[model samples]
Target: MTQCHEDRVTGALSVTGNAGGLFHLRDGAVIAVESAGSPGVETLLLSSGGISAEDWDAALVESVGTGSLQAALVARGSIGLAEVEAVAVAALQDGAFAVAAGDVQECVVVSDSADVPLLPVTGGVAPALLLAETAGRLDAIASLPVPLSPYRDRVVPGRATKSMSGERREIVAHATGRRSARDIAFATGRSLHSVTVEISRMLGEELLEIAPPATAFSFSHWGLPSLRPRAPGQSSGKEMDWTTTPWPPNCGRSERTSPE
Candidate 1:
C-alpha cells in the first residue's frame, strides 16, 4: 500500500479511488488526491457539515469524470458523531491502506497497515499546526489598515459637519489638506468612487461648499446665523432702550396716546 499526505490552508479535500480527479469538498471547499492505482482500493468522502455521504458520491462522480472508483469504495452515512471511525473500519475491510479527507487531523487512524499510519495523511495541517496557521492568518487580516478619504483635509468647521459615516469621519479627521482623491484613496484603502460619493452627498446637504476650480482653497468659509434680540418691554420684538437719551441708526421713536 502507498501512503500520501497533503496540507491545506483554507478549503476542504476529497479523494476518489486511485484514478486522480477533482472533487468538491463543500461550499468554497475542494480536494485533490492521487491514488496508487491499486485494485480493491476504495475512495471515501467524509464530511462534517450538512453534506451527506451520498452527496460526496454524487460530487465524486461529477468531479472525477468516471464511476470506476465509485464502484470500488463503499459510501456510508454518519452524522455529527465520529464519521471517521466508520470510514476507517470500512477502508480496512476493503483491503486498502490509504484514506483521504478534507481535514487530516479529523481522520482517525485505527490500523497500522502501512509504514505510516494506515490513514493517508492528506488535507489541512496537523491539529497543532492548524491552530498556529489560523492565528497567523487572522493577525494579517486584522493588521490591514482601514479605508479613508482625501477630502477630509479641506473640512472647514461649520461646513463639514454633515452626518458622515465612521469611515468618512476617519478620513476627514486625518486629512493633511494636501492630498488628492487618488492619494487619499490609496492611503485610506477606499475606492475613488466611494470617496466621491460621500463628498457629493455632503455637498448636496450644504455641509460642504465647493470652491471654484484653480483656487488655492477648495471650500468656502462656514456661516452660522446669529440669534435675534427680543423687545425690552414686550419681550418679543426688537428690543430698544427707551431710558437712554438717543438711539442708534435705523431706530424709530414715536409716542401716540390711545383713545379709550
Candidate 2:
C-alpha cells in the first residue's frame, strides 16, 4: 500500500490468503475496498433498510451497462447521494478491518482499472490514514486477554451475568457455539469488527468461552463413553470415568436459545 501511494498509481490491489479482498485505488488513494470475509455494500444497504430489495434490483438492472450502481441509484432516487456515500464509507472501513484481521499472504497491484469492480464511494481516503486506523483496531484486539479471529473460533455463552445488555447482550444471545464472530456479524447485521471486539471483551469477562468443534463419536465394544476431558491436575497414571462437560448454569433459562 505504501508503494502504491508512493507511485501514485491507479487500479486495484488484489490480495489472496485465508480471507481475500480487493482494495480499489485511484491515483494511489483508496476509493473502496471489499472483503470476502465481511458483509459488503449491498448487504449493508439492503439489510439495514437503506434501500429496498426491489429498488436495489432495479438500480442494478439500470446500471448494467455503465457499471456504476451509485449513479443508477441516485438517478432513480432509490438512495440519496449522502446516504449512499455514508453506507459505502462504512462498508469500506469494515472491509479493511476484515482483511487486516485475517491471514493475508500476498498483495499485487493490478494496474488496469477495468479489472477493478468496486466503485468510488467517498472522494478517497489516503492509504496511510486507513492503515493507521486499521492497525489501531488490530492492536486493540491483540491487547485483549483473548484475541479472536472473526472467521474462526466459534464461541458459546459462559457464566450467566446480568451485566450484559444492548448489543453485547444480543451478541451473547447469538453465541450458541455455532457461529464465529463473522457469522454473528452477518446474522446481527453488525460490523465484524464490532462483534469480534465485543466477543473478546466477553471472553475476558468470563462471559463467553471458545467452543470445541463438534465431531462424531465412535462407540467402543462395551458401550458409548463420555467425551469430556480429564480434570486438570489429574495424573495420567490415575484411571477414572470421564464425565460430560456440564453446560453453563444459565444456559437453560426460559428464553428462546435456538441458534440461527
| The best candidate in terms of lDDT | 2
For candidate 2, which ten residues in a row score worst on lDDT? 248-257
Worst 10 residues of 1 by lDDT: 94-103
lDDT of 1 by residue, 35-109 (tens): 221111123433223345575556456545543333222242333223444443333222111222111233222
Q: Model 1 TM-score?
A: 0.22
lDDT of 2 by residue, 1-260 (tens): 98998888899898897667899988888888888777888888887787889988888898888888889888877678999898888888888989999999998899885865444775678999999998998898888778887888998888857686778888888888878898888878778787888899888888888887761122234222334443654423222234333432212123333442
RMSD to native for every prediction?
25.2, 12.7
Per-model lDDT? 0.35, 0.79
Model 2 collision count: 0
- Global local distance difference test of model 1: 0.35
Candidate 1 displacement at residue 91 in angstroms: 47
Task: Score candidate 2 by TM-score against the native.
Answer: 0.74
lDDT of 2 at 19: 69
Candidate whose TM-score is highest: 2
